[model samples]
Target: MKAFLILEDGTVFTGTSIGSAREAVSEIVFNTSMTGYLEVLTDPSYAGQAVVMTYPLIGNYGICYDDMESARPWPDGFIVRELSRLPSNFRCEDTIQNFLEKNDIPGISGIDTRALTKILREKGTMNGMITTREYEDLEEPISRIKAYSVKGVVKATSCKEKYVLEPEDSKLQEPVRRVALLDLGAKKNIARSLVERGCEVTVYPCDTPAEEILASCPDGIMLSNGPGDPKENTEIIREIRKLYESDTPIFAICLGHQLMALATGADTFKLKYGHRGGNHPVKDLETGRVYISSQNHGYAVDPESLDPSVAVPAFVNVNDKTNEGLKYTGKNIFTVQYHPEACPGPLDSGYLFDRFMKMMGGNE
Candidate 1:
């Protein structure tokens, strides 16, 4: 069926429908990864957005359930240049069309994705609608798109209950370092990464109190990546402040990184077009070495707002010189604005997870 993608700016792109026939309106953003469409679809960080895959061809390898980062797909909708009908991977279990249909994700294919990405890049990210319904007048859809905002997404995407994950069998006999992970819509790999490194990970909902987490006597605390503006989570920030006051080792990623900055009096601002790709390069200030990293966040911590006595910028994006990571002064805390788990991206920055383990005094 014919589908229309109506942008907030009154621009419309018509294409064949690939997913559900239902309508979807969301903040439209683009990702540059050539592969990992499955991971992108299931990532909790995409909760409130409709993703435009810049890669021309998608689902050639098909969907592998094992590669999913969350229990379900989180994007409001999907957009692509072309959809592969016949996947040829040995691990392929389902076609992208079937996955989207089963998950009720609306998508558009055969559109000029490059042009769409260019618009988002030049004009910054904007709201858009995907629908199979034909509209002679674009005024109403554009207005609705403009009024839409991504809110309450953290709670919507977060786990409903706390759960524990034991270390991998290889690390089972080793001394287990307990980690309290505050799941601000965490990707499953975050817990799996810690579990692989001999840590007993207790995953908690985003709204869990600091006192309750502290009472568990965990050796370390972890703040996870999520969706939306970091400043909107005032209660989570307050709890994070309490966590900061404690001497326990702490590590944060993406949204967590932004919240830690806010909790410590630093400010955050949305990017003109946020980083949402696998090949972003970041330079480690201490080592003067750069690593290609996986990233997916719309907001960044303001370096100028940080007090040197509290924390300092640790890593920076090579593309825009934006803050990529922070190192707290006089505290065993470090945070990065990129994903170290690298579900669908490069593994260069995976060492940061080991660094977190080290911070907790765990043996390598």
Candidate 2:
């Protein structure tokens, strides 16, 4: 089936429908990852947005049950240059199109993805409309695009209830290490990573009270990445502040990093276009080493806005000089403005997960 992608600026690109035959409107953004399409599709960070893959030829590895970041795919729609019809992998159970079809998500393929990526890069991200067939007057779609908002995206994509994905039945006799995870639209993989390391994870909603969390007798706390403005999520800061009363170790990523800074009396602000790719370069201050990381956020923690006495800058973006990570001098809290889980690309920061595990007194 034929499809058309219309940008907010009246730019249109024709393509072929590859997934479910449906029309939708969303903020269009591009990612530079060459693999891990399953993780990208399931990541809640892409909620309320239509993702355009810069790398051509997606779905080569096929879809498996293990790589999902969330319970379901969150992108309003997906766009790519090509979708492989026949997938080749031992662990593959289904094709990309089948997965999207099962989830009622729409997608467009056979378009000029390189051009689309370039446009987003030069013009910043913009709202876009994807239709299975062309329409006569583009006014309605354009109007819808203008009115689109991702403010409550985290709530929409978040897990309505909690569940667990443990590694195996190996360490049943050991003391159950506890980690309180604040699910600000958290990804399943992060929780799985902690569980795999033998920690009994208790996932909580974004607004869960600090008193209740601490009452659970947690050895550590984790802040999750999510969508929307960090400043607007003031309630999370209040929760973090209450957590700071104890000596429990705390770790945060992406939006969680932003909230951690805000909780420490720092501030956060929006970026011009934000970083949404998988090849962002971040430099660690203590180690003096640069690591390629996966990032997906539109707001960053302002180092200058931080209370100088409370938190110190721990990392910086090598390309844009933006603040990337922070560490509390008086407490055991630390955060990074990027994805260290490496869902789609460079695993340089995967060690950070192990660091968190070690902090919680679990064997790495």
Output the number of the TM-score-best candidate: 1
Q: Candidate 1: give the clashing pairs.
A: none
Please give, for residues 1-364, the per-residue lDDT of candidate 1 as tens digits: 9999999998899999988999999999999998899999999999999999999999999999999999999999999999999999999999999999999999999999999999999999999999999998888887888999999999999999999998877787356899999999999999988998889999999999999999999999999999999999999999999999999999999999999999999999999989999999999999999999999998999899999999999999999999999999999999999999998899898888889888888875
Tens digits of lDDT, candidate 2, 115-134: 98888888888889888867
- Cα deviation of 54, candidate 1, in Å: 0.5
lDDT of all the models against the reference? 0.94, 0.84
TM-score of 1: 0.99
Indicate the residue-level lDDT of 77 in model 2: 95
Q: How close to the true structure is residue 7 of candidate 2, measured as C-alpha lDDT?
A: 91
- Candidate 2 TM-score to native: 0.93
Model 1 ranges with Cα > 4 A deviation: none
